[model samples]
Every structure is written in structure tokens, then in C-alpha cells.
Target: MACMPDSMRARYDVVIVGAGHNGLTAAAYAARGGRSVLVLERADHVGGAAVSARPFAGVDARLSRYSYLVSLMPRQVVEELRLPITLKRRRYSSYTPVADGGLLVDTQDDAATRASFRRLTGSEADFEAWGRFYAMTAEVARRLAPTLTEPLLPRSAVRDLVIGAVGEVAWRSLFEEPLGEVLRRTFADDVVRGVAATDGLIGTFADVDEPSLRQNRCFLYHVIGNGTGDWDVPVGGMGAVSGALHDAAVAAGASIVTSATVTSVDPGASGVEVAWTDAAGRTRGVTAGHLLAGCAPAELERLLGGDDAARPGGEAPASYPEGAQLKVNMLLTRLPRLRDDVDPVAAFSGTLHVNESLTQLQDAHAQAAAGRIPDLPPSEIYCHTLSDRTILGPSFARTEAQTITLFGLHMPTRLFRADPDGSRERALRATLASLNSVLAEPIEDVLALDAHGAPCLEVRTPVDLEGDVGLPGGHIFHRDLSWPFAESDDAAGRWGVETEHPRVLLAGAGARRGGGVSGIPGRAAAMVVLGSAAG
Candidate 1:
């Protein structure tokens, strides 16, 4: 039997702050475990960063605004929750343009893909290398997928596991070495190398030679998602994923409160007291057996009041992440014309890579590292309405309406912090101009205007994200992604969500193997609570 949300009884077994997918997921698991759960969200709607909305006024299209695509989410979470989610396969994988006819990676046609590679690189060896590299990643995924859900494996044990699964050669090449050097070593052409390395630079603001090898971590997460690394489009936009999770948690009898801003948390040996301001601006406090931080670690620290209470010698304070991606969602009157003979439908159907050649990518990174947005912003784009037409309103569909979401790489938060508006405008101009260099027509020519008579470009710089969605430094992953393996003895063989504080756990992107739309962190956090109860 589920206890109703009673003001008289102001305590719950679990109080999860932030109703993002991860928090909702944790709430669902806790509720299913027969523990009273309460989820507090600052926004009126749930689904934190992963959400869909009509950003432009008077626009009928629903765009997957902040976090788009479905890659890292595991099927186990969906099955366990019985979520009604649908994912559509992109017919094309990716298309990168070059001086030649350009490279098209088709999901179904191997002959076409090989030919495209041959056309772009003019080498049969490069085509074979591409196949071998993907095969290696596929094998790595097969071996590592199960480990993500389990307790953290020791670093040495994880190394051995990788060696056994793929090979010692791959372990040294992909895991130990930097991704940039690995790509150069694997591919013959610079364009091919650049395309392959784009995964390594999704949100990370590092080059291949950086000592931390954070790019490698970023690459591993990008490729190993779902054990196949295939990024599928969710029907009904990203909000559907959240909607399903919200439904599951609610159905499981968890109490969810919206527009509730958590003010502070006082953790004790027996329980935790959480204070928050409600939508009505009234202060409310509740006690819970455990408190989960679905926001960033820094936010969690603030809620705890300070870092003074942190375990003296625990893992170094969580790194402040600087995101290097700019998201632009637009309603297109029609797909932009392509430079190559390829149809815009085919190009936009999947990931459309623009100005992302090897030398270009490296140059962009160098420029951005030097404290300037790249002159030619490397980017990739995809049209959501092509796969899921339901996001388009009936009347708007008559206008041949579509939604294009562009993700520009290497635009770190630092670039936007000094002058938010000016930086965003400059980035948008540079990004679109860079995009225009490859297109037969300017994308601006194909955009539909909002009611306010402005082009329907809803730009989301890191600054906008930080203010609106509460991602510190606008980092999509909450913090730098931790290695899947335990880095120290204290963290060994434990659920990766555990923190220095015994009763507090990370239910968001700060946890190990935490990135993308995957609810792995959320599920792992709940398991820790459940395990403690069992013990």
C-alpha cells in the first residue's frame, strides 16, 4: 500500500531533489521497493535537461530542446518500469561532405557506405579500417555493457576485462592512448580521422593529447551506448522518455512536487532533513531516510551548506565541468539544399556532419582552446520531424514543416560567460556561416518565422542552459564522467553513485558511466538504497 503525500506525516524513505529522468527513475525504484518516495522539481514540468518544448513563440513544433537523442538509456530500466517509449531507427547513420561527392554512411547498405568512404578518402584500405574499428567498438560494447549496471570494478580488473573482451592491442590503442592519436593511426585520411574523433569531443573541451584522457572517456561513452552505440530518435520528441519515466514513478506511488526549490539539507546518522521553497513561495521542510542529489555535485554541496562536512580524505572535490557544445533548434520551412547530389531528405534523415573534417576539427579545437569560438564551427544536424511527424501540428504540416536541431562542437561555456548575448550572437553567426559554406543554399532561406517575425531559431548557449535548466557550467553530464572502474580502494565494488556522505548519492550525470539520456545513474542510485535496506 502507498502512503499518500500527507503534510501531517512530513517524512519519506527517499527524497529525490530534481525531477529529471534520473530522479524520477530513482523515485520509481524506491517506491517499487515499498519505500515512500518524494521527488522535488524546481520547474513546473519534469525531465530536467532532457525535455521537449516550443521554444519559439507561436510555433507549433515541439523540439527536443536541451538533451536530444536516445543512446545511453538501457533497456532494463524501460522493461522494469514498463515504460511506453518508442525509438525509431535512423535510416542513414552519418554523412560528411568533402571536396569529392562526400561520405554517406547508410545503416542498411554496406556497399554504398564502403563506396562513399572510398570516394571521400580514395583508399580501399581506409574503408576496411573503418569496418575493423567499428567491429572493435562493438566487441568492447558486448563485454562492457553488463558491467555498467553492476558495482564498480577495480581499475586493474576493468583493464583485464577490456583486454580479454577486445584485445590488449585495442586496450592500448583505444583506452590507454589518446583518441586523436588512435584515430590518426587507424585511418589514412585526415577527414576520416576527424569524423571518427567527433565522438571524442561531444561535450569534452580537450584535445587528443591532453593528459587527463577525458576525450577518451567521452569517446568510450559515446560509442559504447546500448552496446552498439547507435543513436536512435525517440518518437514524440525527448519529452516522451521523460513522460514515460514520470508516469512510471507516479504509478509506482511516488509523490512528485513541482516548482519546489530545495534550500538546504541537514544529514544525520538516522535521517536527513530537506528544506525547500514551494511554488507558492512558502518554506517547507521534510525528513527522509535518504537524500539523492539529481542536480550537479556542486549544487548538492551547496544544499549541504558547505564542503566542511565532506569526508576528510574522500575522492578529490568533484571537478567543475565546462561543456563544449552549443544546441540550436529551429523550425525549417523546408530542408536546406545540399551541396552534393544527395537529397536533403537523405542527408537530414540521419546525422548530417558539416565542416567536421580532420584538420578542420583540430583547428576548431585549437581556436576554441585559445579563448575564441572557432571561425568555422564544426557541427552536426538532424531533422526530428522526418522520423516522428507527430511533433508537427496538423495545420503546420501543410507548410511542409520540419524541425532541425544543430549541435555545434567546441563552443565551451567560457566563450559565452563574458558576454552571454554577444557571444551567443557571434556563435550563431559563425555556426550558420560555417554551415552555409557546405550547403547549396543558406539555412536561413528555409526557416519559418515566429509570430514575432523573427526566424524560428531558438538558440541555447551554455549560459542559457545554466540559467534555465540548472546545469552548472552548462555541462550536460553534470560533471566530468568518472571512469567505469573504481579509481580508489574506498570506491571499489560499490555502486558508483555513492558519495563521501553515507546517506547521499548522485542520481544524475555525475555518477559513473553517467552521460546521455541513459537512466543508469538513477537506477544505480536506487539500488544502493535498496541494498542498504536489505543489509
Candidate 2:
């Protein structure tokens, strides 16, 4: 059971919907600015998709159930909010196994990485090309990352910044060409191409040559994080990240109401009226000067009477946004041995690419788009315990038990819509098989059992995300990611969080430059209300 705030009032200076990390960020900033703020969440707790849980009955290991990894969150937000959070950098970057050996990217040791590349590719060409390509991206990331925290710049301004930082060729390759085309042109080896292309297709369901440039947008976000593009694992799982934000918001005097389902939102001349059904089934309404929707654009549309034309991006398209990935969480008794000589700690510490070669990824996407699960689903595996063992309980922490999270590409909601249970089971089997292909033994051999003697493994498909997290069609970015720069001249200088309504703003992943676990949109929205462009 949940209860409304003890000091609930009839009105607030600002009202934010959804108590996810973004909503909590807005509440903290708005409240710290001496404004009365209220945050309403439909779930009983905070941290929407970015949460930690002990799914297995009687298990003490806490896993980042969804939205694992921290990137794109600006250091400014962390410093300003005084968040007690630590992000650990993994020593090894990634390891993609091949038939003979494997390509291991050891960030701490370039010589070892070069040797691994030479052993796998039989030359130094791809390794040198890799260095040059990322070097170009590093310059671009350094120049463009800061702009994400600022007001939207015109397309030309951002382009000029990239062109100045890197060169015309770098700009054209990253911004103008399809990411697939760029990858194919940059690398000669298929495995190398796949490794680079995976960044572009993380949560996106598109081929390298998809004309829409969706992969390009996804690739851009992946590389521009904190000017380094290195994805860090949050200490103590993702729940800690949300927990810190929740505490900050509460300390700043924001009123948070949980299990409060917002029913209606009416924006008018005076202010915005928001009505919700509380945990007690009692309807409550409040008015605020502004409403920050920290939810999907589609959910916002539904609250406003299902008007498709009123969405943030204008009229609804033929279909809503759909998330195209499968997330699997597992607890293992001990790390599995690899077929290659590389240590398990090195391979699983970072990203373990399984059957994600460029050609295989393209084939998988085509198969999924054609309404069948890919026979060999491409997936990446990560071991949280290798980077940070704090997520495990004391007893488990002292042992060899570990947490493995597998993210599969191209498992869209459409594949599971017809028969969710059937498709999920199928997808899960296919994904595990794909992973097993590169392992010394079946992964099932090392899976730890819960108290009930059941394997401690759980899977979440896009359809599952839609039901559990309120993501429309389970689209992870809330919608297709927009270019960081303004799409049109008129939109320049705006926060990129402005929606169709004057008094409402998008404070979620749907906002421009909004995606992943970054609280960027929430921070930007608060800046808009505070009349500060450079907050």
C-alpha cells in the first residue's frame, strides 16, 4: 500500500509526471530553486526501468534488471545535485570471439589488444583503422558532448563544430552516411565491422544500410557520452543511481506521490490541471504552472485524450515507437570457461559479443523484420560482478557467484506481439544458443539455482517492457531518437524538451538528446522553467 504526501496541497509551482530518474532530477532542480514541486509516479516505487531487483526467490544477489550502464549523464548534473554515485570503468573494453581466436580490446593494455587483433585478423590494418576511427570520434565527442547540456543548436552549427573538430571526411562519415555504410567502408574484416556496427544497433532495429539513418543517431549517442563514449557501470547497480536522485529530490522539498496514475492533464491559460487516481483509489487533482511529462510521448498523448496530432513530434505516424531488444538477467554459480585462452574475467568483464559479426547482424535484422525470430540472434553479455561486486549479498559476494546480463539485438515487439509467451521462449532459446556457440560449455551448466531449485534466469522482451515500464510499444528511447541539433531553424535555441503544449515539456527519453539512463532532459526542462539556458 502507498500513501499520498502528508503535506499534500492543492497546487504546486511545478508538477512532474513519472518518478523515474528524469522526473526525480527535475523535481530536485525545481525544488532546489525554491519552487514547490510535486512528482507523481504510477509505480509503487521510483526508478522506472533503471532499477535493481532480486528476481529469483530467496536470492541475495541484486541485479540491474533493466537499463544497465551509465553514459550520457553530464558531470555537471552530478556535481550540482551532489549525487553520491560512482561509475566504475571496466578494464577491458570488449572481446569478440572468432573461430580461431578472439579480438579482445584491453583498454589498459594497447599492446595486448594489438596482439589480439593481429592474432584474429592476421594483420595490423584493421587495428590501425580502429584506432584512427575512434580517434576521429574522440575529437567529435569532445566538441559535441558539451552542447548536449546546452540549448539546441541549429543543424549547421553542430555540423560546423564536428567538421572543425575532426574534418570534412569525419563529419560526412558520421553524420551524412548510414552507420552501416560507414562501418563497411571503415573496416575490412567482417568481425571488425560487426564490432563497430553493434554500437549503432544497440537498441535500434535497423540494418547498417537502413535509409532512415536511425542507426546513425543511435551510434552518435553511444560514442558522445562524457566526451569519451565509455559506458560505465554504476556502483551498486542502477537502483543506486535512482536512489541518489530520489534522495536529492526529497531533500530539496519535492512532494512525491507513488502509485498515482495520472488520469487527465488539462493545460490552459492560467496553469495546468493534473488529475490522478492515488494508491487509495481516490481521485486527486492539482494545478501547476507547468507539467513535465517524464514518460513516453505516446503516454502523454493518451493522457491528453489520445490525440495523435498533439504529440511532441506532431501527428502520430502509421505506428507507435517499438523497442527492438531482449534483456536477460542471470545469476551464475561460477563463470563459464571460454573456448579461447583468454581469461573469463577479461572476456565477460566488458562486452562479450556473440555471433554479432556485421553480416550476421544484418541477416538477423532482415529475419526479424520479416516476422520470424532470427535463427542465430546476436547478443552481448556482461558480468557486473567483475566490475563491481557490491551488488551481491555478503555471502554471495565472498563466493564465485556472478551476475550476467545479456542484451539481444533485433528482437522487436512485433515478433512477440502475436504470441508473446511463445516468442519469448523461442527468442530466449535462440539467444542462449547464439551465446553458447562461442563458449566452452553450455551456459545452462553454470546457471545458479534459487531456493526453489529453479534456474535464476529471467527474460524481458519489448512487450514485457511495455507492460512493466509503460513504454509505448516498448520503445527504449520513448521514440526514435531525434538528431541532437534542432531539426528546423525555428526550433533552435529551445531546450528541445518543448512539446506541442506551451505549458508542458517532454522530460523523458523522447526529448531531443534524451535517451538511455541520462537525466539530461529532466535537467534541461528545469533550466527552461528557471529561465537559465546554461544550467
Candidate 3:
């Protein structure tokens, strides 16, 4: 049975800071293992970036809007928690509107997608090879999922020996060929190749042509399970997934304190002391034997007095990846116009890549690397209204397309040699202009717009999360998935759920095998704590 809180008690066996999915997962596992646990969230509600809110009077909007699609979450975590998810699965699709008024749509149906690819490249062999490659890549991704969800340590001595032997064989299998070499050998058409490379570079700073092609396979990991090769949004909105996770944590005997901003973490000889201010400006302190930090590494560093040297030697202070992001979420009154060849539903299902080819994408990435936004920037747009008909359907008393989510990547956080406000407005205008060209009509007259850059996002959320999103130089998988940092040393190979700190653990995206909506880090962290206690 769960224990009811006693008056003014500020101590527990474990205290998790940050109510993001990972943090909650850590708390849930800790409590289930017979440890008294408490979770603190800076936001009024849980689900850090993976939250849903009604920005407009009647329309629901997502915060940190573009990070909604989920494919990277591990299946084990879902099964362990028995999360109630009403997945609204849809096929993946993408459109590239050419400058010559031509639009190309890539659909999920293998035949249709291949047909589209052949139209761009004139090679049926290329089509067949692309399918073969996707199959193989997906197989590797499936094999990797189990490794991602659990702690990277062997469970038992015998199990460790078995894994070590098996790992030797597996490592030898992949050593025969580099991932980029494998892709090149599989696909003959650049268009097909470019399509495969798109997701690989989505949230990463790495160039598509880089030799780290195995990392691309990890990007595909997010889209595999839902019977679609693309990421899917939940019914209602992204918030539903977070809501389900939050519900699971609360039901598992965990308490979430919201609107509670933690100011400092004083790690004493016996336990860690957490100081924070409540919603009413009252000061408070909580101590726990084990402390799980859900905030980003950098933010946690700040809370811990910016003691970079205090971290285990060789662990660098977390920093933002090379590229910064500007997210724009709008509530539209009507659906944007689509070309005759384009499907309206395609807008909402998969990410729509606009304004660049592979070469252009490379150029844009280079420009951002140099701290400049490209003149012809690459933009990714998603029309959620088309996917979830309920969002605006009831508001208009009919099935209507009203809300759109747009995330413009590689936008120069610094404008081209101009004043701050002027530069921001110019960048915003450029973004709107690029979007307007592909959109059916102008978006300036839309209901409302909420926009934020890295700094602004850091202010709203934890600075470390922003850093994590921009990890290992903004490559989403933190590092090349195939070349995960080895865990032989405590100074290296430390991420989600487990860290060098004796009782301190990471339950956020910064942990090894980091990032994503899947609460694997939290679950893994809890297991680690439990296992230690049991021993």
C-alpha cells in the first residue's frame, strides 16, 4: 500500500525533479520497488516538451510544437506500463513543391512511393533496391530496440557472459561494411537515396552525405512499429500520449508537484537537498537518498552551482548542438491549398519537406554551421488538422482544416548582420514567405502564432533539454547509433537513467541512448535503483 504524506515531511527514499515522461517513469519504477518517491515538475503540468495545450480559445495546440511525432519510444516501456494509447495510425507522405509550380508527393504505399521515385529518377531497379534497403534497415532497427530500453549493463553474471559473446559476433557482422557504403550499394537512384536520408538528418546537424549512415537507421527507428514507415500522432493531439504517461505514473503511487521551480541541488554527505519556490513564492526544501534530475545536463549543472569540474573527469559540460531551432504553431481558419497530385491527408501524416533537394539541404546545414540562415532555407511543415479531423471539425460545425504545425529547421538563430528584433522579424517573414509559396494561401491572416527560438525555449523549459535536442552537435541520436560511446569507463558512456554519481541518476534525454518521448530512461533508472537496493 502507498503511504499517505505526513505533515511537512521533506524527505524520501528518492526524489525525482522534472515531470517529463522520463522523470515520471523513474518515479513510478522507484515507488513500485518499495521506495518512497516524490517527483517535482517546474511546469504547472507534466510532459515537458511533449505537452498539449489549447493556445486558441477553442483549438488545442502543442508546445515545442514540432517534436510531436513518436516512433523512437521503446515497446517494452509501453508494455510495462500498459499505457492506454488510442493510436491514430496513418501512412507516411511528403511533398516537395518545385519552383516551376510542380509538386511531387511521396506516399507510404510501396508501389505509389516507388512510382513517385521512378518519376523523379527513371529507374525501376532503383525502386526495388530502395524497398530492399528499407527492409534491411528496419530489421537492424528492430534488433536495436531492446538495447535502447534497458540499462546498458548485463542483468546477471551468466547473462553478462552470454551477451558479451553474442555482442562479439554481432559487432563482427557490422564491421564488414560502413553504413554509407551499404546504402550506396543498396540504392542506385539519388532521389530514392535522398528520401531515405531525409529522416536521418531531420533533428541532426550532421550532413546527409556524411559517412555516418548507420545513424540514419536510428532515425528510421521512430517510424517502424505503427504499421507505417513514418511517425504518427496520437488521436486528439500529442498531449494525449503525455497525458497517458502522466496518468500511469500517478496511478503507480507517485505524486507530482507542479508549478514548482527548483533553484538548487545541494548534494550533501548523506543525501541531496533540493531547494525551490512554490507557486505562491514560498520557499521549500526536500531531501532524498536518491536524486533523479530530469532537467537537461546543462541546466542541472547550473542548479548544482555551475561546477563543471565537479562532473566526472572527461565529461564535458553539455552544450547546444550547432543548429538552433525556431518553432511556429498556428491555428488556421482553413486548410492550405494543395496541388492536384497532393493528398490533403498527406500534410498531417508524415513531415512535409519543402524548399530543398539533398544538395540544398547540405548547403542549408553548412550555412547554419557558420551561424547564418540560408537564403533559400529548408522548411518542414505538418498540417495536424488534416490528420485529426476533430480538432477544428467541431468548432466549424463541420469537418474543417484549421490548425497547422510548422517547424522551420536550420533557421539562423542569428539574423544576417542586423538588429535583434529586425533580424527576427525578417527571419519570420522569410519563413512565412517560403511556407506561403507551398501553402495554398497566405498564413499571415491565421488565428494566432506562437513562436520561440533556442533561448526563449530554454527560458520556458530546462536549458539542458534544449542542449539535448541539439545533442552531439544536434544529431538526434546523441552520437552515431552504430558507434555508441563505449561504457567501459565511468567518465564516458553515461546517459539516461544511469550516471557516474553514486545515487544520482539521469531520467531525461541526456542519458546514454538519449532523447525521445519514450520513457525508457526513467524506467531504466528506476530499475537501476531497485536492483541496487535489492543487492
Winner by TM-score:
2
lDDT value, residue 137 of candidate 3: 45
- Candidate 2 lDDT over 436-515, as tens digits, reads 99999999999999999999999999889988888877788988888899989899999999987888898999999999
Q: Which window of 10 residues has the lowest lDDT sum in candidate 1?
A: 308-317
Task: List clash counts for every candidate, in order.
Answer: 0, 1, 9
For model 1, what is the error of residue 58's alpha carbon versus the real structure, in angstroms, after optimal superposition?
A: 1.7
Question: 530, model 2: CA deviation in Å?
Answer: 1.0
Error of 2 at 295 (Å): 0.6
Q: Report the Cα lDDT for residue 160, model 1.
A: 91
What do the candidate models score in CA lDDT, each in turn?
0.85, 0.89, 0.58
On residues 1-535, what C-alpha lDDT tens digit does candidate 3 reach at each position? 1223443887878888888777877877777678877787766777776766655443334433435567666556777778777555455656655543322444446667666666666657876776555555455445545556543542233234333544443332233344344445666754445555556555555565455554343454443442234466666666777777777777777777887778888776678888887779888888878888776665576677875432221234444332244456666555566543566566545666666555666677787777675666666766665666554435342635355566655653233223544555556666777777766766665444334311111111111223333222232333333332333544232334555557777767666655566676677678777876531
| lDDT at residue 469 of model 2 (Cα atoms) | 89
RMSD in Å for all candidates: 3.4, 2.7, 6.2
lDDT of 2 at 249: 92
Cα lDDT over the full model 2: 0.89
Ranking by TM-score: 2, 1, 3
TM-scores of the models, in the order given: 0.96, 0.97, 0.79
Task: Indicate which candidate wins on lDDT.
Answer: 2
The segments of candidate 2 whose C-alpha lies over 4 angstroms from its true place after superposition are: 1-3, 6-8, 307-317, 532-535
- Give the alpha carbon lDDT tens digit for every residue of 96-122 in model 1: 876567888887998988888878877
